[model samples]
Every structure is written in structure tokens, then in C-alpha cells.
Target: MEEYIVSLNDLKKSYGSKSVLDGVSLHVKKGEIIGYIGPNGAGKSTTIKIMLGIESNYQGEVKLFGQDIAEDSIEYKRKIGYVPEIADLYDNLTGFEYLTFIGELYGLTPQLADYKAKNLMELFGIGEVYHSRIASYSKGMRQKLLIISSLLHNPELLFFDEPINGLDANSVMIFKEIMTQLAAQGKTIFYSSHIMDVVEKISSRIILLNNGKIAADGTIEELKQINQEGSSLEQIFNELTGFNEHQAIGAKFVSIVEEM
Candidate 1:
């Protein structure tokens, strides 16, 4: 049998009368870079939250490293790293302080955490600002800091939700290469993003969630084969989501702007 690093079976989550995740089942094998995409409010974040063990109260099983999370969520978390879509950083803390804190939380010694934080910042070209407060950092800088923090302890399973949100082109290129290299080293990456182009380039497989369920899941080549031939990932996304109003919407918006 093939080994799976992450598995979800009949997963379901609801808030009050409305359902968010209506049975999501998936098996993520080791070293696969799975790009997760969906329209707004498609329960993408909820699915990731469940896998990270940050959200419970759902029905079904979520297994990471061949063990059900419900059985022991805390212990297994040491092997995982997550960069959420939205997170609040400690504005008063310096970059060095914050990253070391995260590393320590993941079970690294204080001395090792500090040493690694310094080297990573230097490699990322942010070593000059290591002592600067997070509040003083630009959007891209802060985003980079978060990414660094996630990898400080070198977790095997990574969940990065919109991790490249404010990254510059150069940073984005480096990150893509880093992701590929990590996968080559047997790291399992579940990356969620709305940027179709980047997703197309980096993902070994793509999973589209729509209406509280997985709409499509396959390699980019497989997705292309099933949908319109010679279509781009963005085009395929629109077709799969039944979205054809872009031209109309753009014209209407431009007309409204010119009305004044």
C-alpha cells in the first residue's frame, strides 16, 4: 500500500443551520505539492483549519502521519507548520524575537532557534532589520517573516494559505523554487491560494473546492485533458466554477467610472 501523509474521510463541518464542509475526503501522499483553490466562501479555509487541528466539532476522521488527529492532536502538531491567510503578529516584538519564539514553541532549543533565525533572516536579505519591530516592516517584509517563522523548526507537513500574499516578484520566484525543492526532499505541501498562475506553475496536483465539496482534483495535465483543450488554469477555473461574466462586469465597471 502507498503511504499517505495526510488523510481526510467523510469530513463535515457546520455552523448553526448552514454547512461549511459537506464531506471532504482526500488522501495526500508524501512529497506531493497540492495547490488548493476555490471561489470565496467555498470552505477552503475551514478545511485547512480542520487539518491543522485548529478547528474541531466536526464529524469524520482527519489523520496526519497515519494517526487520527482526534486521538492525539497535540503531540503530532510538532511535525506540522502552517501559514494562515490572516494572522496577527506581535507588533511590538522584533523580528528576531518573534521567530525565535515560534521556533521554541515547536520544541527547538532557545540557542538553536536564535542561531537559525539569524541565518534565515540573512539569507532572506532581512538581516539588517532583524532588530526592527514588526510594526515597522512593510507588507512584503512581514509576509516574509511569517513564512520564515513557519519553517523555523523545519516541519514535514506544511499548510500555507495565501502565503505569497504580499511577496514581490523576486521573492515569489524564490519561494516557488523553495517549495519545489522541499517537495523533492519529501516534504508534503498543501498550499492554498487565489493566484491561478502561481498555482499552475508550482502545484503537482490541484484541488478545487466549490459549494462545500471538492469540485475537481487532479494534476494540471489531467484537469486540462478533462476540460477545454489548451485552456489555462484560470480559464479552466472559470469554466469549472460556471463564471462567464468577467467581460460584462469589466465593461459595466469601466462605464460607471467614466460616468462622472
Candidate 2:
């Protein structure tokens, strides 16, 4: 039997009368790279927040490594690394200082934390600016620091939301390679992104969410077969999510702009 590292059972979240996630359920096995794609406002971030134990008011059960997350939040969190969509960091601190702080939080010794932080920064080509304040770094530089911090502890599972937002082409390539290697080492990854091509190429399986529900879940080839012959992941996504009218919407906006 395959061991599932993460499981969500009939998960539901709401704010008053507004339903953000409605009976969402899924299971991820070890070494699986799941591409979690959805249109904006489709509850992707909400679901992630619930899984990471950041939102405790939701209804349903989330288990990590066969243990209920609510039973022990600290232990659950210790087994996972998360890279949120937003790069929220202390701008007053230098890159090295920030990473060292994160390392300490994860229970690493000061000497080991400093060594790993410096080595990782060197790998990402940011060692030269390690002493510079985060406020002085570019967006891409900050993102690199964030990625390093998330991976410094070598968690068993990773959750990445729009991780390629500020990365250049070369850095994006490097990031993809790193993800592939991590999966090969039996690390489970939940990757959420708007870049269909990258997700289609990298994900072992894809899950499409819409209107607080899972619209489709399958391999890329399976989803394409369900949509149409020779359909790309983008086309399959559009068909499932009712976003095929975007081109028409864009044209209408252009015409309206011209009149203005």
C-alpha cells in the first residue's frame, strides 16, 4: 500500500454566508508532485491556508503523515515547508540575518544555520549581497532568499504558491530542476501556479479547482483526452473552468479602449 503524506477529507471553510471551500477532499502520496491550478477566487489560497494550519476555523479534517494536524500543530508544521504567494519578510534585516533567524526557529544550531544559509545563498548566486539589507534587494533576490529559507530545514513535504512570480528565466529553470530533484528524493510537493506550461510539464498529476470545488483531477494526458483531441493543458483548463471566453473579453476591452 502506498503511504499518503497529506490527506484532506470533506474539508469545508466559510465566512458567514460566503463559502470558500466546499467539501474538498484529496490525498497526496510520498514523492508526488501535484499541480494545484485554479482560476482566481477559486479557493486555492484558502485551501492551502487550511492545510498549513494557518486557518483553524474551517470544518473538516487535515492529516499529515497519518496524524491529524489539529492534534499537534507544531509537529505537523515541522514536517512541511511552505512558500507563500506573497514574499513577506523583514526588510530591515540582511539576507543572512533573516535566514539565520528562520533557521533558529526550525531548531538548527547557530553555526550550522550560518553555514547552510551562506552555502545556499552562494548556490543561488546571492552570496555577494548576503550582508545587504533586504530592503536593498530586488524582488527576484528576495524571492530567492525566501526559497532558500523554506528548504534549509529539509522538510518532508513542500507547499509552493506562485513560487516563480519574481524569478527570471534562468532562475525559473533552476527552480524546476530543484523541484524535480526533491521529488526524486521522496519529498511530496503541492505546487500552485498560473503558468500552465510549466505545471503541465512538471506535475505527475493535476487538480483543477473551481467555485470552491474540484473540477477535475487526473494526469495531464488524461485531462487532455477528456477535453478534446490534441488539447493543450491551457485549453483543457479553459474548458473545465469556463474561461474560454477570455479572448472575446479581451477584444471587447480593446474596442472599448479605442473608443475612449
Candidate 3:
């Protein structure tokens, strides 16, 4: 039997009478790269927040490594790494200082933290900026630092939300390779992104959510097979998410522009 690393059972969340996640259930096994894609406001961020223990007021059970998250929040959190959509950092601190601070929080020795920070920053081609304040870094540079921090402890599970947001083409390619290698090493990755091509190519399985519910869950080939004969992943996604009016909307926009 395959061991599940993460499990969500009938998860639900609401904000002031508005439901964000409605009876969402899913299981992620060890070594699986789950591409979690959804339309904006489809509860993707909400679900991730609950899983990461950022929001605790939701109803339902979330288990990690066969342990209930609520039962041992610290232990559960220690085993996972998360990169949120927004890269929130202390802009006043230098890259090296920030990473070292994160390492201290993870209980790493100062020497070890410094070594890892330097090595990872060097690997990402940003070692020259290690001593520069974060406020001086570009979007891509800050993103690289964030990635380094997330991997500092080598957690068993990684949750990445729009990780490639400000990355250049080369950095994006490197990130994809890193993800693939991590999965090969039996690390579970729960990736959320708007880049359909990358998700379709990399994900072993895809989960599409709409209106706080899972609309499709399968491999890319399976999803395409379920749709039209030659449907692409984007097509399958559009069909599942009910976003079929793009062509019409585009035409209308063009007509309005011409009238103007």
C-alpha cells in the first residue's frame, strides 16, 4: 500500500458566511508532484493556508505523515517547507542575514546556516548580492533568496505557490530541473501555478479546482483523453473550469477598441 504524506478530508473554510472551501478532500502520497491549479478566487490559496497551518479556523481534518496537523502542529510544520505567492521579507536585512535568521528559527547551528546560505546563494548565481540589503534586490533576486530559505532545512514536503513569479527564463528552467530532481529523491511537492504549460509538462498528476470544489483530478494525458480527441492541457483546463468565453470576450474588446 502506498503511504499518504498529506491527507485532507472533507475540508471546509468560510469567511463571514462566505464559504471558501466546501468539502474539499484529497490525498497526496509520498514522491508525488501534485499540480494544484484553479481559477482566481477558486480557494487555492485558502486551501494552502489551511494545509500550512496559517489559518486554523477551518473545519475538517488535515493530516501530514499520518499525523493530524492539529494534534502536533509543530512537528507537522517542521517537516514541510512552504513558498507562498508573496515573498515577504525584511527589506532592511541583507540576504545573508535573512537566511541566517531563518536558519536560527529552524534550530540550525550558526556555522551550518552560514555555510548552507552561502552555498545555495552561490548556486543560484546571487552570491555577489549576499551582503547587500534585500531592499536593494530585484524581484527575481528576492525570489531566489526565498527559494534558498525554503530549502535550507531540506523538509520532506514542499508547498510552492506561484514560485516562478518573477524568475527569468534561465531561472525558471533551473527551478523546474530542481523540482524534478527533488521528486526523484522521494520528496513530495504540492505545486500551485498559473503557468499551464509548465504544470502540464512536470506534474505527475493534476488537480483542477473550481468554485471551492475539485473539478478534475488526473494525469495530463488522462485529462486530455477525457476531453476532445486532440485536446491540450489548456483546453482541458478551460473545459473543466468553464472558461470558454475568452474568444468572444476578446472579440468584443477588439470591437470596442475599433469604435473608440
Ten residues in sequence with the least summed lDDT for candidate 2: 224-233
Model 3, span 58-145: residue lDDT tens: 8889989998888988877877888989867999999989999999888899889999999999989899999999999999999999
Model 2 whole-model lDDT (C-alpha atoms):
0.91
Report lDDT (Cα) of residue 43, candidate 3. 94
Error of 2 at 56 (Å): 1.3
- Best-to-worst order by TM-score is 1, 2, 3
lDDT of each: 0.92, 0.91, 0.90
> Candidate 3, TM-score vs. the true structure?
0.96
Model 3, runs deviating above 4 Å:
258-260
lDDT of 2 by residue, 1-260 (tens): 76589889999999899998999999989999999999999999999888788887988899899988889788778778899999679999998899999999999988888999999999888899899999999999988998999998999999999998889999999999999999999999999999999999889999999999999999998997877743788888888887668889999999999994
Query: Looking at candidate 2, what is the lDDT of residue 133?
Result: 96
The candidate with the higher lDDT, 1 or 2, is: 1
Which candidate gets the maximum lDDT versus the true structure? 1
Per-residue lDDT for 40-99 in model 1, tens only?
A: 999999998888888989999999999999998788889888898888999999998999
List clashing residue pairs in candidate 1: none
lDDT winner between candidates 1 and 3 = 1
TM-score of 2: 0.96
In model 1, the runs with Cα more than 4 Å from the true position are none
